[model samples]
Target: MEQGIIVTIDCETRTTREINLALREASLAQTPVRLSNPDCRHNLAVGVTTPLSVEIDGHVGYYCGGLCDGVDIRVAGDAGWGLAENLMGGRIAITGAAGSAAGATMRGGTVIVGGDAGARCGIAMKGGTLIVGGSVGVLSAFMMQKGVLIICGDAGEALGDSLYEGKIYVRGMIASLGSDAVISDLTDEDAAMLEAALGDAGIDARPEEFQKIVSGKKLYNFSTKEKEIWKTAL
Candidate 1:
């Protein structure tokens, strides 16, 4: 397909390998592609490195759009585990709920989930932003190193557990905080950022309506003096 041309691939008629090949080809040419009847397939468009637009018409299974760089992908239905894992750049939008480990270990870009997300959402995320329009499950943002996780609805227990430098914002009730995670006063800069991010993601809440969670920095260096904190963190 030529660059700028809109390509449509029906996933129901092709093998996974064939579909991925077509995606890669379209990515190289910077063409916008639409995938029909994905049927919750796994590993579709795994490693396209160029900037392109892709629209997946139905639900997707594990690792969909993983390891991609600078691609704009939209999933029209629910997503399985490890959605957009290790993404290097660009954006991924999921219209429905996501399974566990969504956006796991991603280095950059944005992931927007229109519905709820399961456990360990944004786990070990290194950079960028993850915006969830609904509630997130337990241990969400666990061990997150960097980036921002915005939960427009409630958050489950141990949210932001053992986090290094990531920030979490929740608009609804938090069941319980994780070890070494502390609620901090929302700064003006934080409010501005939240406003921009939420606005961009099409989330309707104001920044002041949310609470910010950050690392207490007690786990930066383990010591016997802080043994009690270490016990839970470890």
Candidate 2:
């Protein structure tokens, strides 16, 4: 186990194959691992079975940690598409920007992005907490189910198309709402829930300032006649 101000060193020389090798040899259980290189393109530390604190100093490619649990992960830079594709559970902190579909179809965990997120940020997210600081592009949460989509900045058009059984919150202006989602009037229960989730995600915005996006029930599955009717209409 390397110990000191610099405990671990993985220069992102190769794909994640080399990076994970460093992670495996680092003895992270014995020390705090820090990947200092910023230019590393490797998909480092994709699936960490061991519990450790890993901090990457720069942007990373897709599926940084597709599925991980019982670890504290922090990214000091931006992330590519599908940052945490199918996170089971853990705490992920992003200090920089994030790309499209940051947490696509994730089941559990918490994702915090301090900067803007690209389009389709959390499409089909089943469970988990996604917090985006800046704005997002069109179709941010299309078909989102069971989870929370927190947008501290504005949201683009057609948010949560055909969504079902999920909640979305935005602080800035909204461009449009999809067929399966809308800004429902908040009840006391909803306000409380939003406030609690935002608090857990380290977001300090008030519930009143936050706009909640609720999904529509139409897109859950296919209907018999209306399915064809809608298809013809389109």
Candidate 3:
């Protein structure tokens, strides 16, 4: 492994503005950073484009690690809304629960949530992999264009609502299925894919336990007949 420089920031003692400046500086240098006392600040570590490792020791607010690419961020505690939103590349591991829209619109990357996530998890995701060890809330994966969403626990109502080209796997009970979203066959290839995703997230769950969800193809080509279903995407 390559040894990198370590930059530590004590959030409790420093202003959030100062902390963000230090974080940006370290990111520019491609150095590993340790952040303590996150204090629920929003937009921490957004837009990083370097290969860096960041360890956050406490809970964070909205948009943590958003728009990140080529970086790895690990949060030791719960995260607020939109964690890793619009991420392009890299990995974000959350050891605790996450708020709404976790991994929303992510194009590429891996986001692992160790606990339950709030509503709209993985919404509008164009590409990437999202693995949640616990449950997710309503409208999860709404309008997802492409990607993989794996839920090890129960999924809230309207799971995968209006899903377009994404693959959703839920291991537990689904309260309801979303419009244009239906249960699909879990093939051997899908099992292998789920296995790999679980392994990558360090989750010890059987792939066979999952149920797959995919677009119903009813709205794929979009005709007047599909108008009713298209409302679900909005």
lDDT, candidate 2, at 98: 83
Model 2: CA > 4 A from native: 1-6, 12-15, 24-31, 221-234
* Model 1 backbone overlap count: 0
Alpha-carbon deviation at 164 in model 2, angstroms: 1.8
Positional deviation of residue 217's Cα in model 2 after best superposition, in angstroms: 1.4
Best by TM-score: 1
* Alpha-carbon TM-score of each model against the true structure: 0.93, 0.84, 0.92
**lDDT, residue 223, model 3:** 88
Report the lDDT tens digits of candidate 3 across residue range 1-234.
134567788888887678767777777777789998898877887888877788999999999999899879999999999999999999999899999999999999899999999999999999999999999999999999999999999999999888899899999999999999999999999999998889888899998999999999776776875776789778
TM-score quality measure for candidate 1: 0.93
Question: How accurate locally is residue 115 in candidate 2, as Cα lDDT from 0 to 100?
Answer: 90
Write one digit per residue (lDDT tens) for candidate 1, span 37-57. Answer: 999999988898898899999
lDDT for each residue of candidate 2 in 1-234, tens digit (9 for 90 to 100): 333544556564545576676665553454557876747364666676566567888877677766766446788888887777777777788888888888888788888888999999899899988889889888988878789888999998898887887789899999988887867877798788878877876767888888777965766678888789998999
Give residue 184's lDDT in candidate 1 (0 to 100).
96
State the lDDT at 88 in candidate 1.
92
Point out where model 3 deviates above 4 Å. 1-4, 224-234
